[model samples]
Target: MKRKATAVWKGAGKTGKGTLSTQSGVLKDSNYGFSSRFEDGEGTNPEELVGAAHAGCFSMKLAFVLQENDFEAEEINTESQVILEDGAIKEVFLITKVKVAGLENDKFTEMVNDAKDNCPISKLLDAKINLEAELL
Candidate 1:
């Protein structure tokens, strides 16, 4: 139940660059720097990675919740927006588009909210998290 990623940085703050590598080898020595994080640059950033993780976690949780309720999801798409302000993560906005058969809108909304609240990543974040779910 443990995962790890390593970051190696060189030089000083503003111009310093780093490489991020994960245990899974999906991101082996991926580069990141100040411009990539704060401005438009050609590399991956921490916030983008966080957003991807959040989206993946929320979607999987929603799928599990539906299955536990005797339902199955046809498809689930999620987008997470990570907002940083004053050098701190302020909020995360989760937008979901779901497709399920034989499920009421109210029930879907309820499950979406439950997933948002119960997802491990969501629970770990100490910031405002909002969900906008669309049932299709």
Candidate 2:
């Protein structure tokens, strides 16, 4: 099976006010533990959450880049696919899109790379990162 992570961003970065979600369906007022072996679980595992964080962080980082460039992204969506190999996270595939006016593909790609390279999550991982980006 494959695990994936995704995040979406809209409008300005500062304009983003968000909510929180817990894997055990909101651990509020509840005891938490594991129910299954390493093979399975009732909730998500660390790998999935890591991918999800990478996606969210990438989107926000891209948003920051846009805002810094005096541009506002109408929306941005990013998906990160995490691959585990040899008992380690081997690679991450990032697919992302941005909708901003008058932005060249080259510069957009540059900014995307910048975010991919600089996001805290990305910095934490020691895997090869590949990206596909689109500007609309």
In terms of lDDT, which candidate is strongest?
1
Could you tell me every candidate's TM-score relative to the true structure? 0.98, 0.71
Model 1 lDDT per residue over 1-136, tens place: 9999999999998899999999999999999999999999989999999999999999999999999999999999999999999988899999999989999999998999999999999998988999999999
Candidate 2 regions with alpha-carbon error over 4 angstroms:
1-42
Per residue, candidate 2 scores C-alpha lDDT tens digits across 1-136 of 5433333334443433222245445422221123211345344545666688899999999899888988889999999898878879999998998889988888888889999999888999999999999887
**Which residue runs of candidate 1 sit more than 4 Å off their true CA positions?**
none
Each prediction's RMSD to truth: 0.6, 12.5
Instruction: Name the top TM-score candidate.
Output: 1
